[model samples]
Target: MRKLLASVFVVAMMIGCPAAHAVQPDEVMEDAAKEARARDLSRELRCMVCQNQSIDDSDAPLARDLRLLVRERIAGGDSDSQVIDFLVARYGEFVLLKPRFTLHTLLLWLLPPLALIGGGLALWFYSRRRSKAGSATDPSHLTEEEEVRLERLLAAETSDKQA
Candidate 1:
């Protein structure tokens, strides 16, 4: 019974061991050149589901379908620009990682600089207001009564310390 249990444990451990990964035998490439072109195009296309990753690097089902569609288009002899246009037509400009510059996208491109200029103007206006309001005190600006009182207080403090 002990030997049988040990064999069973050994067999289970062997079954659980990691094995080398291999692509499935059923998958076949209709055209290797098209596959390469698709891969290159997919590298430039962002995965909408995973914004930071390109479609080529994403494992999401949508990314896989997009990759396959790109391959099919390339195999159909579509130029790079034509493939991109088709995708844009189907999925909007948001599908692109770097959207093209246009009147519609002008605000998206200009907002950062516009915000910076506005912020700089605000800071300048605020600083100008602060300076004009005389917030910084000068020694000459002290009133005669205040100077006298300060001198008397200092004298009293010094005498007390000496005592």
Candidate 2:
């Protein structure tokens, strides 16, 4: 029942908010299938100008050029891989929204998990050390002279309060 309600809410949100695609009418291909392919490819290619936004979602001039270039490649009967390869050749791996897993990209993929594990280990060690060290000012570790002084201070305060 909870899953059903959550699914309904998700459906409602999707219906209520349509995606804001930036594909200009003039850039759309005459062939519906080619247009769909181009759109899909555009979504997978990042806009170099926007850095983080896909070409399909960016209004930048460079993004529009990339969209057109994608349509041209698709129209020329280039396979998706061929088109991606062409772009990667022209613009380096930064052109793809999701980069391929290769030795060159190993650090990009491994850094996040490595940082997380490193942070967790560091925190665990810190907490363990703190626990073992105990509190610097813990009264239980006081010497005989210190304990005698503490008792004397407490008795003096008690007597002053009563008076």
lDDT of each: 0.77, 0.91
TM-score of 2: 0.71
Judge candidate 1 at residue 148 and give its lDDT: 96
Clashes of each: 0, 0
Quickly count the clashes in candidate 2.
0
Best by lDDT: 2
Off by over 4 Å in 1: 1-40, 132-136
Error of 1 at 117 (Å): 2.3
* lDDT of prediction 1: 0.77
Candidate 2 lDDT at 34 equals 89
Candidate 1: tens digits of C-alpha lDDT, residues 9-56: 998887664321111122224667766677678877888888777787
User: Which whole-number lDDT from 0 to 100 does residue 34 have in model 1?
Assistant: 62
| Candidate 2 weakest ten by summed lDDT | 14-23
Candidate 2, after superposition: displacement of residue 132 in Å? Answer: 1.5
TM-scores of the candidates in the order shown: 0.62, 0.71
Q: List the residue pairs that clash in candidate 1.
A: none
